[model samples]
Target chain A: MSEKIKFTIDGKECYAEPGQTILEAALDNGVYIPSLCYLKDVIPAGSCRICNVKVAGRFMTACTTPVAMGMEVENDIPELNELRVSIIEMLFVSGNHFCPACEKSGNCELQALAYKYTMMVPRYPYLFPEKKPDSGNKKLFIDRNRCILCKRCIRAVKDEQGRSLFAFKNRGNELAISLDHELAENISDELAEEAMEICPVGSILKKEKGFQQPIGHRKFDKQAIGSDIKSVIK
Target chain B: MSKPVVATTSLAGCFGCHMSLLDIDERILDLIELVEFNKSPIDDIKVFTKQCDIGLIEGGCCNSENVEVLRAFRKQCKILVSLGECAIMGGLPALRNGIPIKECIDEAYLNGPTVSENTEKILPNDDELPMLLDKVYPCHEVVKIDYYLPGCPPRADLIWNALIALVTGDEMELPYEVVKFD
Candidate 1:
């Protein structure tokens, strides 16, 4: 541990221990730092770049950057807001994000983030990549149309779990997640469930849970996971 | 200080399993009396030890490297636990089956605006990347797993209970809610 550093988020003066990322500190204090790629406990990849904030003058991913003494951070800058919106828009276009039919509707982090930012219509045109029908795995299926390729699933399997279940099979947006095997019988429904939990969007969702709860009845949007704490402001 | 040696690794996952490992708030410190954090990315780590009493793995295997790691842990640890969806099933990355691999690559690097000019030149470039399987698979397809704690990052309680069972030798019987596959 070292000396505390001071910064401001949403105009609140905040203190963080040395080496703590700005996102972690803000999160500890109940300040929301919007992120899809930066799951706690995992090595934060800062891939989504949605949590970028203006520190003094320039912008940076709050999840990756370490804190310094007396650093000024503007988390809600208009430019950062625009960047977040654009990133969300890109994510929407990149995949088949049909919220109406998907399972993760109410609890979808991407949907919640989108709503938080008030993005009703996608600014960018849909990628509309003609995708293969859901593999009908009998257990789970990956609707690539809804995927954002945050790579959280890949990193989890490879680095965190010591199993390289997934790799960036191709480069750039062409990078669809594939098993190492060239055959279809390699995955199980149990693993699919795990993928569904971390996926922030409707892309990788539970097959059974899909279309089961019609968005409105799903809980947790007004609470903190299983906790009884309610969002008084919401 | 007799801390139980602990090993945490990813299988075929999104690393959310490891995140779930730390999700027990700071109360995890209480368990430190009986558990020693050994080979993990979060703390002091040296050799990839084979004699871990408890092994925690995330992700599923889509490559040879994943296979090797899984074998190493199975050989060393007394108890091996599959942590997340990737390791449990193939995960979202396994979703590449629905489209042609070439179409996926073309749309991303060749046709998409975000494509870097350098991405096209690499050996085994987009064209040479492993072809997508007709369908995604799970880890059990590759190995005989000892225990399955299923959740994208299986609920924290499930993780904690599985660990406690390791000490007690009480075979964990997943509830219908936990194991019922869609």
Candidate 2:
């Protein structure tokens, strides 16, 4: 293997291979860099700013920034953590995230991050924007109200011709993922499930699959997000 | 000294929050020893007999009556807390927030799938009826909320911990397991 690029994050020594991003290296070193919109082996969207880390007085998305030799990065710090918490809070208020009625409540990564940060209430006012759900597709249901526009579905769920199933429909505040019905209608059940799983929020879901996992048994029910990376946190 | 008085109300909620408060289980007796219930459904008191130290409100303001009641609570209680999801952010009732009031009323009283009995197609214009607001409002939007405990029906342990901390003036212990929004 190529000589691992040695670096330090928050004073702790970390190593990275040539092309691995800061987030990948951090995770390999058992350092959890909390992020949304980052799926392993997929092209980085860096749409969600939760994974932003400070390096040399510059804040950049950790998922996109490649690790360098002797790089000093700040992943978890009071100022950065507070900023991260604020981003999470903005995501909560900007969208109509009514967790109680959601199918992906406990399993949701967004909700789990909020839990990790202990957001008692959003700092901003609730917008309560009306975004109706599209249940037109046979296997999938896209609830626009919950979509943070992370582009995970757009980047990951694709047809054999390399056509994306989901695409951005509008601009500015009206921006949303538009699922191509023609492509989506013929989606396999496995792909439908994959589409739902890739979405960080409850925006994309498989139809006819109601809350099958009872409370306390769902994915994030017991463990906080990123807990599996570093069991004993600093 | 007399026990710290606690008052509670359910505005636009399903009373599940109240049930969760009771879900404190045998600790209800312990809670009673720490504080006295006043102007609450648990005691069947319709009106506030006196001033209260803390007022736990479980739901958002959905109507004129809710606003008036919330204002009254603000006047009578020293500390007002938004107890659950509905109170904090309008919850399920607020789903109608995006739609027009006319459409909602028409759908409810006239055009709904279950609507049947109104042969005269009359809408209720009773003077005693509480007027519906344009949209369901979080409690803080109407009046100040000193504290917020967010959950569907906030976990029983969360309610318990918050109550004890409030009554004792100790720091509230917010464990990861209890502070869930689900």
Candidate 3:
């Protein structure tokens, strides 16, 4: 058995196994930390800084930072939430996220986060950067306009041989997620569904399936994102 | 005291947001009693005859005419509200933002697959036509926007609640179900 470390998040005592990161420990203990990129059981890329929390008066990403014994972590606070909201807004203005026309609108995590943060309007000017949709793959399509560069699909969507189906195509400013067309052709339906689920936004979508669930019945429609964890913590 | 005058307009939009306003249904009777319409399509008022307490703008500015109308609203109304995705973030109209204006005009008039009839390849150059902007701009970017209701067409209850809150000076209820971005 691994040694358990006790920590305090916003003054509430919590415990986690030795190898667990702060985010893993927090979620396990029913603490909901707003995150866009970090996914459970996957390697934390720390790309999206939405989960940045103050650890011992220093800001750090909870997903990449491991919990230490008696560590004082600030999870929920106005200062941190304000910063997170700004990050969400920055993601919004930088991309051409037309939520209304998107297939994954109701279930999108980025949109859910915007709702959670009450993002009435982004403070920054909309970049409206030109991007194109790639329908090259038989199973799914990639809408680059809606991608937040979270890298979730790239890190999590892999084949039996442990090969990533998605990858980064270009460098900074022009950086975009690209799919391996050869691998994509043979992707199983299950893996195709997994890719869609793994994507935080509507960027990756199964070709034929769209708006499957009716409005008001979709995920995040009735309940706000992280409500389950919030309930557990409460 | 007089009823709070309200004005509304649709600039570079599909008018879906106005349809959502009508989605308020029976409560619109209540709304009619609570507030008076001035320069809104609902009243078929062509121009602003009096100052309005609230102005609900339904789209972004895509042309010179839209800018003029938006500025007129700003001058006549005390509080301005961006009523949907378009007004808040340039919505679908803003999709042309990434593409160069010249290329867009060419695609629409000269080189597109469906433009076979335009053998003359003449772009609309009428003096009466409003000149298109280089890019679609969110209403807030052009003029000061007081509040934003973000939806393709904001939910009817959301619109009703916002109008009520504004008129009665009551706190607006932002329930999770009503605050969707889509």
Candidate 4:
């Protein structure tokens, strides 16, 4: 068995394997750390910066920082939460995230995080950037207006040869997540569904399957995001 | 003491938020008892008779008229609450924000396929008509918005809880189930 490293998160004693990151360790110990980019088993991108935690006076991305013995991490605190909320607000304003018209309303991780943070109104002014939705693919569509650029779909959705189906097209300010048309055409139904599931926002949606889940019955409908971990810890 | 006076308006919205307010069901009776309507569609009060304690604004500013009414509400009310997505983020009408105002006007009046009867190609620019803004703006952008309830049309329970909390001067309880974006 791998050696376990002991750490303290928000004053709670926690243990994790030597190779695990702080976020993984916290979740393993049933501690909830709100994250958007870091998917389980996938390499940590730390792009979203939503899972930032204070470690010994310096802020660190929990998903990128590895667990260490005697490490003191502040997970759930007012300061960190406020910072996270601000990031969420920035994402909301920068994107044209009209949740009422979005198909991934209740299931979207970004929307769920906004709900968890109780984001009544974003502080920043809305950009309302001009973006077009691509519905050319048979099974899936990419709505650029709602994309938060978390890069989860780009990082996770892959073909049989380990080639990425989704990739970033264009440079900064004009950056957009684009699907490889050739690869997308042959994408299986299951993969298409997974792509939709991996997206943090309502960017990637599976065609012909929307609003299938009724209100009050979808994910994050009854409980706030990461509540399961809190319940488990209790 | 006299009841708290309340006013409400729908600027660039579908009045769905008002429908949600009525969704408070028979509890609207409790609301009527708790507060008196000043300037609202419910009371048919065309103008504010007295200063209001609370102003529930349902929609964002999409035109000069919306801005004017919003400013008037801000002047008349002590607290202003942005009700629903439209009031908070400009919602569906804001979808036009990315496009140029000229293009939008042209599409609607002169060039759109739906326009079948514009042989003279005249645009509505009368002084009586409210001129559209370059883009839709959230309520907070125009004036100080004290509170915001975000939903397509904010849930009935959310509206009720907010009003009750505001009137009673108690901390608002935001249950996870009630605070949804859609």
What are the candidates' interface root-mean-square deviations?
A: 13.4, 0.9, 0.9, 0.8
CAPRI-style class, candidate 2: high
Candidate 3 per-residue lDDT over residues A22-127, each given as its tens digit:
9999999999999999999999999999999999789999999999998999989999999999999999999999998889988999999999987888999988
Worst 10 residues of 4 chain A by lDDT: A225-234
Q: Which rank order by DockQ, best down to worst?
A: 4, 2, 3, 1
Off by over 4 Å in 3: A230-234
Error of 2 at B73 (Å): 0.9
The whole-model C-alpha lDDT of candidate 4 against the native structure comes to: 0.93
Candidate 1, DockQ score (0 to 1):
0.01
Off by over 4 Å in 1: A133-138, A157-161, A180-191, A219-234, B1-182
iRMSD computed for candidate 3: 0.9
- Native-contact recovery for every candidate? 0.00, 0.77, 0.82, 0.85
User: Hey, what RMSD does candidate 1 come out at?
Assistant: 22.4
Task: Please report, as a residue range, the 10-residue window in candidate 3 chain B with the lowest summed lDDT.
Answer: B173-182
Predictions' DockQ, in order: 0.01, 0.83, 0.82, 0.84
Best by DockQ: 4
**Candidate 3: Cα lDDT at B112:** 91
Q: Is the docking of candidate 1 incorrect, acceptable, medium or high quality?
A: incorrect
